[model samples]
Structures are given as C-alpha cells and as structure tokens.
Target: MIRNTDLYTIAQSGLRASNTLLDTTGHNIANVNTEGYVRERTTFVTQLYGGVGRGTTERVINTFAQNQLRRDITEVGEHEIYSQRTSTVDNLFASEANSISKALSRFYASIQTATDEPTNMAARQLVLGEANSLVGQVGTMSEFLKTKEEELNLELESTINRANSLIESIAKLNDKIRVLEANNSYEEPGALKNERDKAIRDLAEIMSIETRQSGNDDGITMVNLTSGESLVLEDGTFNLFGLNGNPDIQYKNLELRSTGKPTSLRLAEVDVGGKMGGLFRYRSEVLDPARRELGQIALSMAAAMNEQNRLGMDYDQQLGSNIFQLPTVSGLNYAANSSLALTANARVSEDGARDLTSADYQVTIDAVTPGAPPTLDVTVALLNPDGSPVTDTAGTPITQTYTGLTAQAGTFEKVLGGIEIEFPDGAGYAVGDQFLFQPTKDAAADLEVQMTRPEDIALASPFRVDASINNFGDAELVSTTVTNTVVDNTAPFDPDTSAFDGAGGIQGPGVAPGGLVGAPASVVFTSATSYEVRDSANNVIVTVAGATDLNNLLQQAKGAPGYPAAWTALNDYPGYDFSLQGVPKAGDTFNISYNTDGLNDNRNGLELANLQNKDVVLSSNNGTTSRFSFQEKYANIVSDIGEKAAVADISLKAAEAMKDQSKNWFESVSGVSLDEEAANLVRYQQTYAASARVLTTAQTLFDTILGAVR
Candidate 1:
C-alpha cells in the first residue's frame, strides 16, 4: 500500500493537473471565434507509478495541421489576384477593337466620297482629311495600349513588394511559435498565430508557396514556406524575385548566412497554375503579340497604299505622290509615292488639230506599267469641215487608218517614220504631217511636233517667178496650179470643186489642201499642229507636234512598250499576300494597272477586286502563313478576350462558392460560441475551486501530522 504522505502528494498533483487541463479547455473555447486561430487541445499522459507512487496526467497538441491551413489560404489568395488581372486585360482588348472599327468606317466613307465626285476639290479634300483621321486614330490606339501595359507593370511591382513584406512577417511568427512551444508555456499565443496566418494568405495571392516543417533545439516545431532554394526560414528572413520584359517570374537565389552557393526560385518551375501565372503569361505573350500585330497592320497599310497611290495617276496626272498620309514610327523607313496627276480633255482630230465639226479624236491611255512606258491610243474621226464624212476626189469618201502606239521612254519622243496612209486603188502615201500628240507612251519625251510647207510658182508668171525665186534662194518653188482657164485664162476659181478636176480649179485631184494659186477650187495642204503631251493624270510632260521633223512624231508614238516590273516588288514584307491572309508588314507595296479596255476609267477595278476577294497573303520570316484580315483579325481578338472574360467571371464565382464552403467547414470544426465558452469558463472556475479545497484539506492533514511529531 502507498504511504499516506506520498498518497496525499500524488492526489494533490493529480488535482492540480486536472484543473490546468480544464483551464486549457476553456482557453480553446474562448479563441474558437478568432480568425487565424488554430483549435488546440492538451495531450495527457500518465505519470510513471513506482513504489508508494500514484499516476498523474499530461497533454499535447498537433500544430502541423494549423500550418497546412495557412498554406492553403495563400494559394487561394494568389488565384484571385490573377483572375482579376485577366479580367482587366480582356476589357482593354474589346475597347481597342471598337475603336478600330469606328476608324475603318470613316476611312471607307471617305473612299466612297472620292468615288462619287472624282473631280470635286472639296470631295478630294474630304477624302484626304478622313484619311488623316484614320491614321491618327490608329496611332492613338497604339499609344493607349502601350500606356496600359506600363500601368500593369507598376501594379505587378507593387504586388511583389507587398508579398515580400508578408514573407518577412511570416518568418517572424515562426520564430515566436518555436520559442513558445519549446518553453512548454501554458498559454498559446493565439493572436500571433492568427496574424501570421493572415499574412501568409495575402502573400499567396502574388505567388504560389510551398511549406515545410522545422524542429527547434528545444523539441519545438514550426512551419515555413519555401521560396526557391532558401526557406522563408523562421529567422525573420525573406527572398524576393521579379520579372523584366518577360512574364517569367524569378525569385532571388539567396544563399543561407552560412552557405556560399546561391539557389534560385522560378515561378515557372513551381506548379503554380493560378491567377498569378495567368497575369505573367498575358503580359509576356498575349499583350506583346497584339501590339506587334497592330503595328504591322498600320505599317503595311500605309506603305502599300501610299506606294500604289504614288504610282497612280492623280487628278494632276503626276506619279509617285501619295493620296493618303502614311503613319511613321521611330526607327521605321516608309517611302511611299504620294504624287498622282490625273486629267481629262475633249476629243481632237487625227490630223493633229482640234476641229469643232469634222476632226473629233478621243485620246486615252490604252495601258500602263507601274514604272514602264504606257500605251496611248488616239482615235480620230476624219470628216469634212461641215461635220460630214469626207470623200476622196475619186468620188469615194476619204478614209484613214491610225494604229495606237507606245513610247519606250517618257511620254514624249521624236517620231522616226512618217504617217502611213491607205487610200483607194491600192495606193498609199506616207505624209509628213507634223502632228501634236496629247497623251504619250513615255512621260519624259517631247510629244509635240511642228511642220513647214514647200513654196510654189505659177506657169503664167514663170519668167518673173523663176527670176525672182532664183534671186530669192530662200524660197524653193515645188509646183504651179492653174484654176481659171476655160481655154481662155479668164475663168473664175471655183471654191466648191476640187482643183484636180477640169471644171473646178488648178492643182486638182492629187493636190493637198491649201496648195493652190488664186484660191482656185479646193486643195489640201501639208500643215502641222502642236499640242502638249500629258500623263494619264493629265500633268504635261512634254510637247508633241513641236518637233522640227514630221517623222519624229510617228517614231515617238510607236516607241517600245513598257512592262509592269516595278509593281511586283512589294512582296518583301511578312504576311504580304497577293491574297489577303495576314496583316501587312512594313515595306509592303502594291501596284495599279489599267484594264485591257481602251478606257482608263476602269483601271482601278482589278486592285479593288483583289482586295474584295481577300487574295492578299501574309508571309513570315519563319515561312509561316496566316490568313488574317485587318477587320477580321481585330474582331477575333476582341471575341477571344470577351470569351476569356466570361470564363473568368464564371471561375471567380465558383471560387467564391468554394471559399464559402471551406469557411463553413472550418467554422464547424473550430468555431467559437459565446454560450459554449461561458459554460466552459464556469466549469473550469468550479474545478479550480475544488482543486484548491483539496489542497487546503491536504495542507491541514500535513499540519496535524507535523504537530503530532513535535
């Protein structure tokens, strides 16, 4: 049996241990409602029983579960951060697409106006003004995107700083937990643990974190989240990382105070499939690519259109001038032809003279090469001065054939041969009529020519004319005509009849007009007319009929034809397609060619048709192909963003639900009820009283025994 004194001591110790257990239970109940507080319990063990000894109880609690809860909280927080960022980016993409659409509408409207009134100065100005507006719009949008990116960067930086601060706070909490656990303190620092948990939750929103358990020298345990190779160790230390232009997040490769080698933490290396990861991916991949695509579209449009407009025949008929103002960026070279000269003229006669009635000639450019000689066809209507079709002296109407010609260089050139004429009776004559050509094959040569007639003398005044002509050697007599004769030399000259006919006048039949004496009958003369040669746009390049030699006119008209080589040189840019597949890159160019029809009005039809069919293809340096249109690609981008935003919204809602469910579960397991805590507090207080009474009774017994021994 146990000794009375030992038994009393054992019972006293047992009573004290029971009261302490009740007090701990009361403390747990009190803090159950507190945030970040982990529910703790005392672990009891029996004290060893030896000779004359009784057993006592001991208690312990598991802290590992509490640490794990903190880590989970961090993960959820990080996910929410990324989700919010994605939402913001998606909205930006949608807004940008809307702006692009509006600008495109304005641009198309301007084009319609130009088509409606080709010659209206106000309409042309409006077209140019609208073009400017479109360019400005594109530029403004691009700048805005850049600005948004900058703002995102700033936000990312701020987040990183906050995360670092939280990490440091968590480390400090770990130190406190270890110290308290080792000392076997009766009271747990519930408030400090809660604060640390909250800090960890906030940190998780910025980046994913992994945790580990650590033991201190006094058999006390604590937890720490791992950041790269270093522990967010419980010693108040932290590791910070950042990203540059890329989306990859890098943590500082920190060396332990004792270790020399460095270890790094990469967000990519960790399995961080959360909102943080999404933000990084968007900034690095999506946003950058979108910006580049926009730049490419702008550059491509400005360069190609400007180049084509440069080659186009403008209202002034000049070449190499842009119809639209092109956007320019730093470090980019944009050389577009903006000069265009287009013009119109009334018809003229084939004899190189303007006749209101008989000489109706329609001048047109038959064909054009981007940088080569063009084909010009001039159709002349041979008619009498009375506007009636002219007939030859053989009682047949006079007819002439003219071939549309080309010039090798420039719009003007010297004619190398005379005009070939076809007449009745299988006879043909090559007349040296100095004619002025309006539109020319080449733009750089003289299209104008001048002509002079040979002098003539009559047979009746042969002696005086011959003597005077010989004396005045500047005049060389070619032929003589006798219009009035009737076998008497007293007949009047007939103005209505041909001089070649006996009833008419002298120099009849084969004689040219104006080659007669005394104004006898009617005659045709070899006269010259001059005119200025212009381009398709009507800008005067040179004069045609001003040439001294009549043969020069024919030679210049039939000069070598030019080929369309310059127009095909615009395929160097990436995504440049004769078919529209991808956005155009910088340096892309295009050309416009006249239709095979004799009219220049339908020249732009082919280009417009090509554009409509989406035949332009986009090429890349990697030899990849993409079928993207300016409008369609942008629209797709907007649609994709909207879809993502919708998905994120759904996900966020789901996450909130999940969070609510978790909170309910947590509350059920570790929630504080005021009634429950109050009841426990009252029970513990009574237990304290009972233990005190037992101690008092034991004290009285010990005192009585001591008195007996005395």
Candidate 2:
C-alpha cells in the first residue's frame, strides 16, 4: 500500500502545508501592530484515508473575542461623548469671578448705589450701564448655547450618514464573502472578512448594534438594531436610519426615522450605548435644561423688577414703565395632518414665573365635542430625558387631561408651568394634533433692557402721607410707612391739609365697596374713653371698646375693632399707623393719605434693592413648597452641571479601564504575536526543508529502482 509514488505524493503534501504555515506566520508578523486585525492560523485536515494529508484547509478566526471587543469599543464611544460634552457645560459655569454671577452682583450693586443717592444722575447712569451689561452677557450665553445645539444637530446628521455608509460597506462585504464561501471552496475570504469586521467596529462608534453569524460556514453575518430591527439582512438588504426634523427644530421635537417611518431611537427610548446615545443625553439632560433654567431666571427677574418698577414713579413723575421686556411663554405648534390650522400663545399668570418648570411639555387634542361653546378634550404629558412620556412611581404615565375648555382665542385660558395658553376659538386643532410648549426656553435670549434713559428708572414711591394743618397734637408720617393703594377722592375731612377731597367718605376713584381706599378713614373720639375709625360715609369701619389715648387707638387699628376684616380682604388694602409726638386733644385730627412727593422719593428704590436677597425663584418637583433667591438658584444650576461633569468623568475613566481589560483579554486570544510567529516561521521553514529532502530521496529511489529493473 506504500509505494514510492505514494511517498512522493505525501512529501509534496507536507511541503505545501509547510509553505502555507510559513506564509501565515509572515502575515501575522507583518500585521502585528494593525488595529482590529486578527491573526490568521493555517488549519490542516487529513485527506482521504490512506492517502496524503491535505494542506491548510481553512483560516481560524475567533468570533467570540471579536464580538467582545466590539462591545468594549461601544462602551468607550459612549463614555467619550459623555465626558466631552458634560465637561464643556461644567466649564461654562465653573468660574464665579467673571461669569453670570459676577455680572449679576455688579448689576445689583449699581442699583444699591442709585438707591443710596436717589437723585444722583451719575449713579442712575451707572445702574443703567450695569443693567445693559447684565442683559448683554445673558444674551451672549444664550446665543452660545444655541450655537452648540446647532453644532450637535449637524454632528448628528453626519454621524447618521457615516453609520449608513459603513452599513452599506459591510453589507457589500457580506455579499462577497457569502459568494466566496458558498460551497466551502478553497478557503474563507480572510481579507474581506477583516474589512467587514473593521466596518462593524466603525459603526459601533455611532450607535449600538446586535449581530448574528448566518449563512453557510458562518460566512454571512447579519446586523440588527438593539430593538431587534433588521439593520443588515442575510440576503444583503439593509435598513437605513435617520433623524426626522429640520435643524431649526429643538432636539425634543425631533424624531428618529427608519426607512421613512418614525421610530424610537432617542437616548432614553432604549439602552442606546454609543456616541449617538451620549449626544442625545447631553441635549436632553445638560444643554436643554441649562437653557431652560437660565430662561427661568431671566423671566422671573424681569417680571418681578417690572412689576415693582411699575408701582413706583420715575423722575418725570410718571408711572414707571417696564425696565425689561420679555415674552411670558414660548409655544411651538406641531404641523397638523389636516388643513385646519391651530395657534397658541403663552403669558405669565398672576402667580408669576417663579413657579415654572424647566421641562418641555406636549399638548395633544384628544377630542372635540360640539356644544353652545365647543369643548376641547386635551391631554398634556411631561417629556422624559429621551423625549418619551414620563411615568410616575407606580409606572403610570404622568398626564393631565382637560375637558370642556370653552375659552375662545386671544385669551390664555389653559394654565401650566405658571403660564397660560390661548387657542383660536373656531380654528381648534384636529384630533391627535400636538403642540410643544417651552415656557421658559427662550426667556433669556428674548430678555432686553427696555428702559433707555437713566431718568426712566423708578426710584420713588408712588404714594404719600400728610397730616392735617389744623391738627392740635404733633403727629407725623413715619419713614417706614409704605402703601400699595391710596384714595384718589377729591373730598377732604380737613380741606386745609388733606390732599384727597373725600377725606371722610370712602367713595372715590381708588375706593370700592367694603374696601379701605381713597381718603384715609378718620379716627374720631366718640368719647374720651374710646374712639371709632370712620370711613368717608361716617360708617364705623372699626370701633374700639376700651378707653385709650390717640397712640393706643392707632396701635389697635391693625386688628378688628379698629380695622374691619372686610376692608382687609380687599385687593391692595391700604392702612395707616401713626405715633403722636405729643398728647392729642379730644377734637385733634390728622390726615393719612396719598403722597404727591413720589416725584423725588427714594423709598421705592430702597425696596427694590432689598429684593436682591429675597426668595424670588420657585423650586420644582419637590412636594415641599420652597423658593430660592436669584444667586441661590443660579448656584444650584452651576452645581448641577458640575456634578454631572464629575460623574461623566468618573464613568469615562471606569469605562476606559474596562475597555483596556477587555482589549487585553481579546489580544491574548486573538492578537498576532511577533515572537510566536517568528518561532513558527523557523519550524515551518525546517519542515519545508525536511519535506524537500524526502521528496528528493523518493525521486532518487524511484530512479534507482527503474535503473535496476532495466
């Protein structure tokens, strides 16, 4: 069975196998430093029984190791994005020296200076300059954030395109590999497989993917989204994914689309684990919320300042105008399916902007019922970090549905986030139409200093108090005396001293039924033992039961008997308290009324300065009702961003460590080793030499046998 020819065949097979092994070793040595390159190993299989052994039949690739490495690559991508973006946000608010904090402090300091020197032109000018600086810086920061958002949008588009390109390349490679290995022919296409794996790794940087090996001899690998959507099919067909929205739209309003159909691929939709996921997270968690919080600050500050300034008087003795102008709400109506149009506008409610939240909301028209006044059944849902509907502790969606809304257009009838939304009456939205309301989103960018001249600043109190010129006792107005409402009545109890005309009657422009306004109610002594507080109509608004002097009578005026509960309940209830410098006679009378000296008064300026330390911002989500001063809320924003950055930095480090560990393990099993390859090179070279010698011997022996037979 062992002929000389057979020996020659066996020797030839050995030589061929040795050459293949030598070639494989050289390849390994050449590509030792290549990234994502797996070493090739020549696998030899026996030929038909009793025949020469077959040369290298295939190249062995470690699928498990490559898969593990891909996952680690994805982790690295995600952490890299998180660390970079969060750090950018943190650095923006890190310094208190020259940032928003410093600007705000300077602005308020200028106001305090103006209050100290109420009529100083230079001081008022300084306050106006500081106000301009403050608004300018806030606008700059908001614009910067808006620019970053645009950059992210462009980057997202490019990333999607890159992913699509890689997917197409991988699918093409699959076709080539499948055809090459369809019959288990000569060997697997090692170069093509390498290229495909590299493409897969590149795609992993953009978004997480799931893969499966299919087809004959594991030649065709199928890829899919983590949600089980077919990304690359066995038959070479693939699905393309994209984001649905123009660059102008905000991220929350954007949607992920697959093959022209809307799909959920937002950061919080599922466990997205790559660069794309990190970008979405940054938009929803860091960038958007920061902008909203900044807007909230601008809105609350502008509204409060304007309201207070309006209640005072400017240098011209005119009622104060708004110092800063801003839209109370921001509404974006989604394009509807039907021709029916919809419009919405939001305005600050009487409760103020401090109670507003930093989250965006969705308003959905559930139904429209016809009636004398048509009703709209609308549902509002808070968006999650990924733009999904937020859920409660019990896993139920947190939603509010308003039914029987009959208000017409031009009036904001729906209230949420301390703002009201107004809709067109007959132009109501169709079912399923949606609107996204961002109450504080653009507040900062829209904030502007409306007061152009220093003289426009309201530094004086609107109301003034005077004593009757005919009074017997020495009673004067206290500097601490403050009032929001005063009577405009022309009648006066003592026409010689009171500014108001209706000094004894409550009826006047500012006075209403059951209200304390117009002329200050007179405290008349019914007896030397007791006095009664009477209105303009001589109605006893308050009566004291105990005997008392004028000082005791005024002190008792704060509570019932001296001040009626009904008058106290009136809007902007006005009251007066006085101290007699000397004893009062039985017929002594004094006037407590409006002041026309508001033209040069600085009392309101002092009050405005006091607002710097007051709690004017509302806290959200916590069950306990709490508030924050301007600086305190700003500090919270800074701290929140810093914490997020720190956490991201730590996570990146941990992920890097994990990735390094995974890489080491993968390299140990799949990476090319130069020393090992060199040793194999020597062994295969010797085997080749030995096999050549054997072949030579077989030839020589065959020649000898032939010669002998001849």
Give the top-scoring candidate (lDDT): 2
| Candidate 1 to native Cα RMSD, angstroms | 26.5
In candidate 2 the C-alpha lDDT for residue 631 amounts to 80
Tell me model 1's lDDT, rounded to 2 decimals: 0.39
How well is each residue in 1-710 modelled by candidate 2, as lDDT tens digits? Answer: 44444778888888888988888888888888877677888777766543245554444556676677788788788879978988887887776543787888888899899988878989999988988898888877788788888888887788778888998899899999887877566566777887898899888877788889884555898997676667788877776766654112655332344543445553232256688777877887788888888887877777777767765667776656678876755456564534334565666653465656565667777887776556678887766434556555566665788887664666566455566667665435678877777766777887888888888888886554455566665544445433332334322221122222323222432444334443345666544545566555556556665644445344466464446444444444443344444444455555443445555578778777776788988765432346888888888989898999988888888888978887888788778877888889989999999999989998999999999999
- Model 1 residue runs over 4 Å out of place are 1-33, 49-75, 93-97, 176-194, 215-238, 245-275, 323-602, 605-624, 670-676, 699-710
lDDT of 1 by residue, 155-202 (tens): 666665675567667777777776775565544565666677667656
Model 2, poorest ten-residue lDDT window?
491-500
| Best TM-score among the predictions, by candidate number | 2
